[model samples]
Target: MAETAKPAPAPEASAGPVSAAGAYLAAGVASSEADYAAAVEWYGRALSGDPANPALLQGALMAHVGTGDMVGAAKLAQAFQAAGGKSQIATVVLIAGDAKRQDYAAILKEQAAGGSAGAVLDDLVKAWAKLGLGRMSEATEAFDKMAKTKGLEAFGLYHKALALASAGDYEGAENILSGKAGGSFPLTRRGLIATVEILSQLERNPEAVALIDRNFQPGTDLEIDDLRRRLDAGEPLPFTIVRNAGDGIGEVFYSMANAVKGDADASFTLLHARAAAYLRPDNTEAILLVAGLLEQQRQHVLATAAYATVSPSDPNFHAAEIGRANATFAAGHPEAALEILQALARTHGDILAVQLALADGMRREKRYDEAFKAYDAAIKMVPNPGPGHWVLFYSRGVVSDALRHYDAAEADFRRAMALNPNQPELLNYLGYSLVDQGRKLDEALGLIKRAVLMQPDSGAILDSLGWAYYRLERYRDAVLPMEQASQRMPVDATVTDHLGDVYWAVGRKREAEYQWRRALSYDPDEKLAARLRLKLAKGLDAVLAAEGAAPLKPVAAAAAQP
Candidate 1:
């Protein structure tokens, strides 16, 4: 059976009326749960009403394209063109389909007509078509022409190096990286990795190691670690970067495509990113970008495959791993995600972020003790933990409490509070703990009151305040706060139970019983469940007698002289 998809926020409602056009627009903005079927329906409706509307035609074409209904996309594109509408999107779709169909001559003809698809793209496609037609010298000349263009030199140079390497010219690729060429591009991790591979292929292991060490140090990520190992082992790596003008233009489009992904048309974004990856098979970043776009469209399996393309030796491997883990978890395979994280942790032990990933994975698996150890490791790895690090302490506190190590849990909470004194969660958690222990009631109440002041709308903090009041026997005062807490956390079992207890303390028996039933339905804890059972079996009086707690009294009446 297929795994269920994770919940995502509902899509923003479409603007305007509920007409066919409006429905189509709404479908465009709908969550992935609505599926392409919904999009097709809406598009059909819009097209039926306004068959020649360019926007509606484009929308329908895209819906079909997304669903891999190529026949439909082609038919719509033909119809759209016959209606005197020149859609850049439709043209690109047609070009891509043509390429897949090996209609190279037609693709070249379209390119010759100056298809205003992409400036850099048109030139690159023309160059590749030349290469495809067995014109090597023309391809080389075309690549050189692109290399001379302003602001496009680096891209051209990189592709030139790849082309040289692919043609068994390792020395040429190395010369480019070594600045034997007139110009130089800043060596990003990807560029450096490719350079190192070229050097290694040329049997220059020392040069490769120098490049790796200079660009990627020991303390960063698993990919660097793996590269370091390969260098140490003196392994000969293969050169894999763009080798032609087509690939260079693809990189340019891919880079800009990533930045504009969610803000622009998905089909267009996918086109640019896919074109980049197609032109440069080893462009991991482009692949990842394509995967991200696919993820946004809810194509989980395809996204996962794209993410997996980032090899262990790529600098972006960690990023890919994270994406893969998230996809796996979203696809309802938490165990698979944990496995991936554990493997990453083993290889990337020195990186704090990797350890944090491990801790998150373990926590999701409910292995609290192991997760605590991972968190501890992560905390120790950081020289001076930031305010964000406080969450680690707070999370560990939860794990500690779950493990019945309340004293340790309190210490972690206090540490987190020290780091972020005004953090309402920490304040409420620690304050609630003290109240539950039935010790330091006054101090707990003060802390909880402060927490409530800090987060007036937080149901948990408000519940803590009410519970503290109930513990202090300020029963009448507890009623208002408890009711407010119940309003905020209407579905929370513990808060509902607390509200019921406060109601009973204030002599509202029927209301208290009603709340108790509500609490039970919400699945309260064993202790709360027992209290609710007792209240049903006997009364609040019997529960108080059994627990050996003092009778309700006003705060002033219960106070003692210091």
Candidate 2:
């Protein structure tokens, strides 16, 4: 991604002030392209010329933070603030650095002076910092103040529970999580873990068991199953979610990061994630969250680097590897993804998540036989898999069909539908395949109708239903859905071609010619193009005769014969 040297700046530019704006523009381009290192370098070049440029200074800070350089980010933040930049990024970076050294007074000072860090985050961090400073009453007040924020009942109450637990007040933590104190809130996975630890601390195993049973579906998640067994056996679950005040503060940032995920751009969220990582280097959950945000922004290299920090011994290591491999694959490095999966398959063979990711990557890379084997291995790990596993069968079915194992593919597709009868994708794939083979026309039409009802807005599913009707010689019925699918998926050659055939069947010769020409413009595969060309010149009946196929039979003709 390195750029070659360009021509020098204008003599007027050299005689006047340096073009920091131009350097910032280049940095922005690199950051958007996922080249954080290049962005950092360019932003630094900008800063050297215009040291007080708030926009350029914060831009460099973000690049440094995005690359996980807390030290460098802190230094840049100091320079930015001294230059009167008024940066929330700088405030958060400085606050994180202070928190890392356990300097609670710095956090309080920043808050007392009216924070440059975001208002919500400033208050939350202050509460956790108070806990670290051994001022329990003040910490409680800050948490209560946060709880009073409109529509933030869950976040505030959740943090207050963590504050209690970290101080060995497990009974108080239990009150909040169990809804006996602080109004009700939906328990997230991390919240559930905290509650489990709290209940175990109070030796209330039965309540913890009930909580697990209420939250998770029967035989759904392995983590839930293990937690249930340990609680049943009267084993105490450790409070690992927030082990200290520092970790609690990190959790505060992580919670806000999740809350703002959809509403904010990636750069803003990346700042909070970076702070969390700084406080707890061993926080695998936080680390993975950071990597995921980077991936969303297309910063795949930085994401992969972040993912690599989770060691093999960590419980979240497989999850990290899966994410890293996906990032590597997405960065036009499929071989890297394949290499990691191959190693992981040998090392973590029993883990279904790892196996599934490996299988999916192989399937994407067109290693069909290897994908089938990996998918089967992943399936076997689950005895009597449930509706959640329809994806495994569905994916395997696709590879099976591609490999021309049609019978096996059909069986897989049927099993997937049986497992999840309402899944529109399963309905569409199976129905479309049957229709394409010119068999079970009635059943195919019914399945496709059900699928269309479930996912009326899905262009692919709509196309499948339309194709089913067309193959049934229900030309009139096909037209509406075919046209709708074409409208939604305008660039799809298959949908365009299908519409052309439906038009031809209805005797709209000019419209049929128009659609075929349109499909050709969109670039159908060579074989489909050749067939389309024959139809354009000789008509459907003549083309069928040349290919040793019977002429199309409309539904009425078949019904009359019966």
Candidate 3:
């Protein structure tokens, strides 16, 4: 499910320039949503002018299959074939169609002739075909054959065992776990759970309990909880561990892939996960692992497809949707992501984590009202709110401030501060808000100073401190800190403008003009930009009059000395 790049649209010959751009834009949007029909229509419009464009051809192939238009896909494949346009995607689609038709022999013949299929997939599909033919012995042998491939033997051995157990050869499966099998597949939590079940099926309840305790003594999940209950009840559990060797290796790769974070090479990790998933079609863990890696690499579209494989019935469905939503947001499709989260909120109403996630997504998109509602719902749902609830209040406070709901914003900030006393961000934000409103100058200065002491390296906190001084009419005293703040946040127009004001108040007229110019170059808000322009045109006194703020006062001689 690694996200593929969206193919560029073909140049439109039939349509006017603006219409062509519109078609291209529409295709881009459709592809992002996986609305293949709409994407096809848009691409077709573009292709009317550039029929021979390879990018359009590639997009058409993807759109056709994504929409389940197999006939259309086949036609595209035929066209590509005639045009000598070879691609892995085209080949895979053809193989997939053959797979649907149960034409295994033909697939095998083609694979042998082509000699270019994904190695793991080639083995797995062949083994599955052997299963379809009711040739259990051959299927088992096929798995063994796959096991012989370098770096893939564990997968083969694992799937072979699952195939054995699934075929009702429980004793044989247990024997494989007992080390009768030549290869060793690394056991995972899931694998161990399956192994315990297999042991129970062999009437080895004691061994099953022992295995569960040995592997999962310190943690619990739904699977482990169920196993514990069965063990207590002395029930014979089924051997549900993968009997297929390919699946075992898939599990191994999937586990490794998930653990690959924070400095691991994403491409290498993806290769393992992809190989494992290819070897085992039903390996949701592997698919998710691939998606997670792709997301870490900022490959959003690929991550989305990988996450899409987790069906609603899967235990990890919520996790997958969360990943999918994050990828969609990362891909700059905030609306689609919000829609997904809204749907999830309805279905997973009782899940506090899901509600929080939805709220967080809304906050990221600056939908303050919607985010506040979600946060309220989350707060109500948590019967005994924990320390983590501070984040909700803090986030809500930010959104409230953005909406100019000062009273509510202050209340939320105070609430968060009470829960997590001396929190740097809360202090800085609340203090900055006060400073911006030109209210409670002394208290705001004190709060910002405290925040600065806690996080001196923070440019935002330093800016607040500088602005507070400027508000207090201590222009000379504001100069150094404001300059430091500007250096730390050199690109921030507000910081630069604050520095300019401090300069003008100290009678450094030329320096003030230079800073004002720099502030304009920083591209601040329209109001700030206008103020800076006025300051450059006349002086800080004129700008202050325009802003209705008190005029700058000269500092005492002792302060001016600095």
Candidate 4:
């Protein structure tokens, strides 16, 4: 919503105006989809004809920054201002360039001139800009001022701690992080790792080891485990989380980027992410964050490139590779995704995330046996699994059901329910399966009813509930929920098909045929489509009779009542 994620592309009226119209609209759609490179390309094409179009210039600049091309953004910034455009993003990019060159005066001048991205951004960057000028007291006071503002205290205090640590004031940083300096700070991976490195700096290796153990479970990451082992063995850990004011500034952008991620437009999010990566090129976490934001934008190629920058020896390398695999998968290269995950499973077999990724890839490809085996491997990694592992059971249940091992599927679903008793998906799946088999009518109804209560807005769950009622011969009860489900999921072939069957059972013959035709139009799978055609040709009851089945009225209804 912020800044429309990208400028509206020009309309393509009258065949193609190429600029100020057609190409501009093309740029808008591309940028909106997070195809920044494509947006840039189209914007460039449009700008050649309408040189002073503020929207096109702004869109091009955003796309440039999204790809971490600060130089291109800076060049566009000049053109934007000359074109009488006031773009906050252009100003930020230029300010970032100044920060990169250690030109604090230039950055401060822009802030003084009322050119800023926003209040929090301006203050934090100004704080770091003061540090670039070697004015430690002024920088601390600036951070303190931001801390006094409502809702900004946490971010301010966290940055202040980073600045203090970078300025060789470990005691001040420790006081803030340990909550002795007032309010408690939110925990993050970077923040926790910073505390560990700081504790190590003070020669409190035992405390650091204890802190890591207390905050994180065993084997949280290979790097953390390595750090703990070294700490216990009395190795002196270096204070390298933030070595300079620029790195602290990078942390500022990275933190805010994470905070406003989904709420803000992807283009706006990339602005801060770009600054984080630019200010501290070696910060692996920031780099990974950049790739993640790009992945959300669906800029898969760029995400893959950003993720590939993290070295394998880095603690966050597996995290980066996982992101890369996902990006590859999203880019319509599931085979490439599978290859990365399969390699990761071999290299980091003990890591549950790697095993899960392999399993997920297999599941997506419909290679059920491989996915099941991978899930088994993943389940073994957790000696005593808890609620967090419920998804593993649920996913394996899906595979089991596809293979027609109903007993195994039911057991997995029930085990998942034990772990997460109120999980809607588990309830719906188990309930629908029981309903389909015409067994445990009361139990199935109870589970699905609870599921509907939890996720009343879910189209799929509503359809399941309706199908359960239909199986129980409560034709009248099935109609309303099925209608709602079809409306909610208008394109879902299965829901439409179920609606058709219910309509037929209730003697709405024309409505049933229309619903069946609508379902077919949605392109169902081959088997379902064939069965639907048979229903249309012979009618539901006649088709049942041909298969030596009981008529829809007495036998099927009686069998469902236990």
Error of 4 at 149 (Å): 4.1
Error of 3 at 115 (Å): 14
Q: Specify the highest-TM-score model's number.
A: 4
For model 4, residues 1-562, the per-residue Cα lDDT tens digits are: 0233533443432354554576777887887787777777788888999878787888889989887788898888878878887768987787777877778888888878777778888889899889978999999999999888899998888888888888778888988998889678787877888888888888899999989998877776777888898999999887777787666767778888889888997777789888888888778877887898887776788999999988887877888899999999988899999999888888887788888888988999999999999998888887787997899999999888888889999999999999989899899999998888778988999999999999999998999889998888887788899999999999888999999999888878799999999999898999989989999998999887897865776534543554
- Clash number for every model? 1, 0, 25, 5
- Give all candidates' CA lDDT scores: 0.73, 0.83, 0.72, 0.84
Instruction: Show pairs that collide, candidate 4.
Output: 9-24, 9-25, 10-21, 10-24, 10-25
Candidate 3 local lDDT, 13-58, one digit each (tens): 3255646567767777766655565678887786677766666676
Residue runs of model 3 more than 4 Å from their true location after superposition: 1-241, 439-443, 474-477, 508-511, 521-523, 557-562
Per-residue lDDT over 62-137 for candidate 1, one digit per residue giving the tens place of the 0 to 100 score: 6665554556876787677667667676766566555545566776876665445666656655665566566757
Residue-level error in angstroms, candidate 4, position 371: 0.9
- Which candidate's lDDT is highest? 4
Which of the predicted structures, 2 or 4, would earn the higher TM-score when compared with the native? Answer: 4
- Write the number of the candidate with greater lDDT, choosing between 2 and 3: 2
**Alpha-carbon TM-score of each model against the true structure:** 0.62, 0.86, 0.62, 0.88
Instruction: List candidate 2 segments past 4 Å from native.
Output: 1-19, 29-35, 145-153, 203-210, 217-236, 504-526, 529-543, 552-562
Query: What is the alpha-carbon lDDT for the whole of candidate 2?
Result: 0.83
